[model samples]
Target: MKHPSVRGCSAIVLAAVLTFGSGAVAQAASAPATTPATTANPLDFYITPASLPANNGDLVRTEPSVFYVDPLKTIRAQASVQRIMYRSVNSSGVPVAVTGTVMVPYAAWTGSGPRPLVSYAPGTQGQGDQCAPSRAMATGEEYEGIFIAGLLARGYSVAVTDYEGLGTAGSHTYMARESQAHAVLDATRAAQRLGNPQIVPGGPVALAGYSQGGGASAAAVELAPQYAPELNLKGAYAGAVPADLPAVGRNLDGGLYTGFLLYAVTGMGAAGGLDLSPHLNAAGRAKLAATDNECTLQSIASSGFLNTAQLTVSGQKLSSLLELPELKTVIAAQKIGNGRAPQVPVLLSHSVLDDVIPYDQGRQLAKRWCGAGSSVYFDVTAGATHIGGYAAAIPQAFIFLERRFSNRSAVSNCWLYG
Candidate 1:
């Protein structure tokens, strides 16, 4: 038998790529449930309190929850978990309630000065409330559970954000960078404020995520200095970042991941207050309706190989829809590396063969950040799919976090990229 640690890692990588091929959607239909099937009533903890705390990251409510490595609940993480609702701000600057989970490992912190907290932003979970990470964590269905469990085993506390409107109210502001960044930073704030002895206030911190999460963590690094300046941020590990939304949209237009393109359109429209009725034809609306309720696996499985030209009223592809003046502005707002460098070092990784997100844009983000004098280690992985790209970066990301938390100087390979 393989070691538990090795077995765990293998399971994680396998689950991450569960929907691997072009025909994976058909496989997903027969796959087990990723989201909760049904419920008599919605969990009240997710309900936003009528009155919110004045400050962002202030804890609103919390309840004890369980964290399982698998949906069978046989293998559980050796940690204490809590389902928390915290105050956060949206892109429009409104105070809103956000849901997330905080995990503190059972192991004692022996290596570091204090136990560091990793504010982990998850990749796309979907646009529905049922698909929230907090819910997934409780059910052992979180695709990122393996990575989150890895942090716990290392004696680091992990704070995983569900992002704005993901589990609370309204539509998920997916790919809206500002709101996503705010949620990630504030989740760290809320975790520290939980008053857990293991995770103290003002403790050293870092960010970790990939894909949508990569973009969120990258955005958090850029916004932390000004928005959450008081945070003791050390570094970030961002993998397969969708740094350029337009480029990502183009890549996902008619490919196996067209569902993601639809998600971006719906999510950004919600965040930007755009009425998409005029832009979407009947087919587009129907597709959005299905995509809205799905989790990551289901979304990819059902909407694979769908062409945007078939969905639009004007018979234009999603690439063309992205060119509209209204969408162009909002989509551009989601772009990362806008000349402002993160105050801390970042480990940015991407695969040369990523099928979901284009690789050049990830490289371009590194160049932009490096140009701004940020200490960035661009770890390039070869011949990996989008999920595989992150899997390959996991070891490097962990090493990067280890160095940053140890107060060691981070090495930059910017010259190599140049």
Candidate 2:
């Protein structure tokens, strides 16, 4: 994911494409016990707190469906896909509706223990219901069609979360750390409880994501010990993780990538129910309203290089949003490093030339997690920008997760660097 430049175009849609092509998961808060028999419409529902069950991460329902994935030259015929509705907590710890896809490979476990699960989180797609992967895939237009195909080809069951409010009612809590983490972790539980032949309950599990997803995977690592301790999590591979949102906002303030910054503002505000009309001038208000229903690519194409200061009544840049008295705490709370170090071994990768998320922040995150005594294998790869890091890190992440699922321990790299 390059900064708000042309790279934002691809990065913005990364999550939407990855999840849609991989499988489908939809919000079913108002649906009956049984899901409708088709993947044609995943967003045909209304969500209310009264509509959600009391249990956190509980499986609300499941729609048995086919995965609209690319050609799998080898890996176990195509995997079976399902649209799932699950319960999860929001930033405020309230039980909220969440949705995502689950894919179970056809091949049985022939290697060793119970078949392992991979919780896949995609990068930023946008802040609209239309951006939901399940809805997009059902339409046969999911991007990154090949990314998830490769994962299924390796014989792993995958679960992808749409996060709170993305497919349901209310605003999407786009980068809220706790909410995203809960969605990722709960989606795994939903998959385990699924009444399917493919899922192996109490099996080893691994987490993987790039860019925004990478950050969520990292958040789940720290949160799982308390939030979802029952999960048999083995390890996580987070590449191009965005540990510092404030720094990102400042960096992209007046640049070509301000679209991401704009998305962040609207997303965070929507989650908090903050009427940003007070802060934005006519231009800012018009831009935000215009991009509300659009996905990342459209958002970028229309709102790039436009200065955030010009949109504000006070002529301040994106930093103005970061500093809003009501929003400051929320933004700070979204940072990832201060939390407990995830007990599982972590494989973290970042590109030296990453323009979207700073490389230093990734390194700083590794250092913090290491200080907290977590076993971390940090990689600083070269040449690739933020989005390109996915291709580079994924192949290596595959090996790292493979060893963990096989119950192998990683030699601690912290001792050498610390």
Candidate 3:
């Protein structure tokens, strides 16, 4: 339960103020009463069955499924039966979409009212859509992402965003906060519009993500108050979040974690409108471009999972490119959790021994939120590494979320008490 020194934690404080201010504005607005649309029609923001690409390849599922959350309790369910290609455009106007399978459980309790929505943002699994579906209903080992089974089993309607680029076109925004947040929130909007006749509309909504997904979830939390105020977000759960990008970059630099750097560079280039090809001389850009769409496994296999030292761009060292002030500024800005405190309650979890992301970032985030008067539960899982920490924290995270929606106050001082 070690806390970062409180001196000069103004960045977090500013974020908190901004978060509250936005929430206040949204709350003050006279929003229309929540209602189910009279017409049982699909939302235009999402792609319908007919508009989907014919050659969706092997990633499509044609089974009918039910997705809903308990109107009375906190449980949720997503049963899969039909699949469609989800399409959306990025800030750059680049069209990005993914093949998504929707599933809702048969026992969903929508009678109490509209259930809460859990729009999930997934972590890195390379540029393929096969493993990026929100529910991991597709066949394959890598497709078994961390929380899909558990969440669907609990009756939560989970809309997974394949991000802006990976499953659709262009480059995926690995950790671009605004872009990732927009994609995650918009996907939830898409889900509401692409409503199943069996499911109710406009339920309380929540956001969750792990690792890269964690980054996206954090962004969604920060953005939901303003971007999609109608979602009625009750809470957010994020674990092993890459909150501080520069800190992570420094730790991973020239080490085994360099693959993330590669992904970051590509993602940033795509999201920020930076042309890495020009930054590197002609030959350097060519070498980097060659590795663009390859999956993480392919990069590791071909590169021997080597550190940055073993990798080079057009004969230039990786460290040299990273040293540039422009790149440094961008990396510094991509830290995940440093943004505004969310309007609703938030569950933040991290492990001290996390091999990838630094634990200090999570601690700092909690401290900042607490100071800003946010009800945050920061759980530091003992002796858990990245993957292990996520597993250990999920049950508690869900429990905390359940309590929030049930109108029960959580033990908000857990971080300080520990």
Which lDDT values do the candidates have, in the order given? 0.83, 0.73, 0.58
**lDDT of candidate 2?**
0.73
C-alpha-based local distance difference test score of model 3: 0.58
> Which candidate comes out best when scored by lDDT?
1
Model 1 C-alpha lDDT per residue in residues 243-339, reported as the tens digit of each score: 9988899899888888888889888888889988787888888888777877777777788887678888888896677788987898888889986
Question: What are the per-residue Cα lDDT tens digits for candidate 3 across 270-330?
Answer: 6767766555655445545545555554544444344454345445556455556766666
Tell me which of candidates 1 and 2 scores higher on TM-score: 1
Clashes of each: 1, 5, 23
Which regions of candidate 3 fall more than 4 Å away from where they truly are?
A: 1-78, 81-101, 110-112, 128-131, 134-136, 142-146, 278-287, 300-305, 313-320, 337-339, 414-418
Model 1 spans with C-alpha error above 4 angstroms: 1-12, 15-42
User: In model 2, what are the clashing residue pairs, if there are any?
Assistant: 1-386, 1-387, 4-257, 25-100, 57-87
Which of the two, 1 or 3, has more TM-score? Answer: 1
Task: List the candidate numbers ranked by lDDT, top first.
Answer: 1, 2, 3
Ranking by TM-score: 1, 2, 3
